[model samples]
Target: MDTLFDLDEAPATDPFDPSVSRPYDLLRHDDGADYAATVTGGGSAVVCGDAERVLAAMPAGCVRAVVTSPPYWGHRDYADPAQIGHEETVFDYIERLADLFEGVRRVLADDGSLWLNIGDSYTSGGRRTRMADRNNAARTIDFRPDTPEGMKPKDLIGVPWMLAFALRERGWYLRTEVVWNKPNGQPESVRDRPTRSHEYLFLLTKSEKYFYDVDAITGPNGRRNRSIWDINTVPLAESHDAAFPPELVYTCLSHSSERGDLVLDPFLGSGTTAMVAGSMARRFFGIELNPEYVSIITRRLAGRAAA
Candidate 1:
């Protein structure tokens, strides 16, 4: 298995920063030479131009499961000229993401499942406000840290529903919308509505019959008593400007995949998915547009390997 970081030589410019020229040059490297070596060892990865192009490189029907959080439309500036989440229109964003998933479907096994974790977005007072912005605002306002925490920033806006609908239109069967409830969510004081506290984990299947080892990934509690599952929040060593919690990655991976299965993260920002996948003894294939984040994820994965 050839990891994306096993390049022959480092590029001249940083790949992730918006200020840098030829930001995608690193992904264009001919690292396929190391693919077999890496994959055979049970943990391999490749970084490509985009999810669409990356999916092309994968062998059809090779992947058993996909547990990823694609770029939330209009969320962050990935420094790439073609940002996946920062689209000009929501319709364009949905179409773009759906297209990527279509490619994902091609590479997935017949019984594979895609556990997609995504939040929502909203327009506030004629101005578009991201859920992240609202969280930041709550923090800036000095809201009581102990107040009831609501949904992840993405849910505050509504991207999950839009994505679910889009994926459904693309022939995916919506199996379940699992709620990832954060036990230690940030405090918020919203006077207009009830405090939000959970995000959606849409489990989609290619067919009614899919390969899911639910018993292997179930929580210590051992029962799906409710759609909500409690998880802890931990900070990253070096933030990638846009990233979700590793716990989120862990939960999705454990619940949707098994050991030695390949997990694909198209928006591999900061490599949280890769890092967690590596730690859990799973194969990971990631496609990150920004080289800076590629480096960050590589360094973090290397650290985990060392640890």
Candidate 2:
């Protein structure tokens, strides 16, 4: 297999420098050679690049499992045109995500599973701007897509279900929908409706019978795990705004993979997946679009290794 890991120099040994971290400046691969080589030659890696292009270049069946949360549509402007969320229409955004996950499906092992954490959004009601919330500053954006066709203002667009069914149509099995109940959910100022307190985590697989360790996630009660996961949302203090809590990643990985399995995260926001995978002794391959987040992952992984 022509693996895409390309290293130009010896891997950085200092945990602070993080040999596993690879810098992919947007679509450019010039600086990622060393990191790529480390991934191909060693166990784990974090790369900076467009998820679609990076997934396309990787060999088939390369990862044992995938756990990710891509940017939500109409959520935040990631300061990149190539970013997934912010499409002209809701359908456009869903189609783009489906297309990107097609590459993800190809690279995933046949017995592998995908744990996707996606949040829902409401139609902007033709509003062009979103004011920054005192609780979540990242909510501020200059542009929001006009109300999607056939949907009125304030209608909840079923982005998570839409993408889930879309991937099912593309041959992935729709396995389960895990409700990620957030105890510390951000407060919404809406008056009429109840405050939103949960997002959907869809479990998908390439085949009907895939690798899942039910015992790994068995609760203290010694009963079967339920679909509702009560994991709190953990936000990054700097660099990245929204990040997956370590407990969330830990739950998904424990159920889907064994120790030392290669885990893939196409949308490695805040590097939660990689960090948790490392702690569990699982190998991780992460691709992030923003270079700033890549730096954050570098320091985080280095910090973990040093500790």
Candidate 3:
């Protein structure tokens, strides 16, 4: 094993400071290569680029697992036009995300699985508010379609299954829609409808029989775990917005991948996937469009290394 870092030293610089330029560049050397030079532990390359372009650079059939929760349709605009979730309509958002996964399919191993978590969007009344406990703006879906085109206001757009079906049509096998039940979900003010406490995590695979370890995620009854996963929604203590809990990320990676296997998280918000992958001794490659959050990932990883 490579001893690329020791746990006792102060990091080269602070990752949380917005002033850090390409935080990884702190490790850049006189030689042409950069901190991403070696591909393990803190040196893992988390390129800040469009997911499609980034995935193109990876070797074919190399990634063992593709786990990510793309920005929900009508969600926070990472201030980048290239970001996926800010599309005009639900179907358009679905198509755009599915197309990106099409690129991902090329990089995933034949026996690998793709786990996607997406939240539903409701037709808006024009007032934008923070997402349930995630401390990010819940963007209103931009286009107002006629009644024939989409459901009326206050109706939930089925974003998760729509993308899942689209991917299934694109030749990936749709495996499961695991419900992420947030037991401590933030309260909604809508009196007309019941409060939503869950999101969907769809598992897609390149082949019929992939590398899921049923025994790894089994429940106390000694059987395979059910579809519903009761995980609470919590922000990263590092103040990362729109970040899912590390427990959720750990469960997915634990069930689907093995130690030392390569995991890919293209969205890489707050670096939860990479953090979990590192703790479990798996290699991770991540891509993020937002430079600020990339800094968060750098700092989060440094904290782990310094521990």
Q: Which has the greatest TM-score?
A: 2
TM-score quality measure for candidate 1: 0.74
How would the candidate models be sorted by TM-score, starting from the highest?
Answer: 2, 3, 1
Per model, how many backbone clashes are there? 20, 6, 0
Task: Report RMSD (Å) for each prediction in the order shown.
Answer: 10.5, 7.6, 8.0
Error of 3 at 202 (Å): 0.6
Full-model lDDT for every candidate: 0.62, 0.79, 0.71
Per-model TM-score on C-alpha atoms = 0.74, 0.87, 0.81
- The TM-score, computed over Cα atoms with residue i paired to residue i, of candidate 3 is 0.81
Tens digits of per-residue lDDT for model 1 on 1-307? 1121211132211112233222122233254532211121225464735677767656677666777777665545556777676665566777889988998888888888888888665443333443444554322211111111343322344668878998998999998898977666665656677666777888898888887666644434785434665654445557564466666676666666776666777777777676666666666777777767777776765555544
lDDT of 3 at 228: 87
The 10 consecutive residues of candidate 2 with the worst lDDT sum are 1-10
Q: lDDT by residue for model 3 over 1-307, one digit each (tens)?
A: 2211222232322223233222233322344332232232442457777777666555678788988989877656567778886666677777888888887998899999998988887666444443453332343233433222446656676778788899999999998889888888776666787988888999999999889898886655787778988877765666456786777887888789986677789899888787777766666778888778888888877676776
Better of 2 and 3 by TM-score: 2
**In what order do the candidates fall by lDDT, top score first?**
2, 3, 1
Instruction: Write down the worst ten-residue block by lDDT for model 3.
Output: 1-10
Highest-scoring model, lDDT: 2
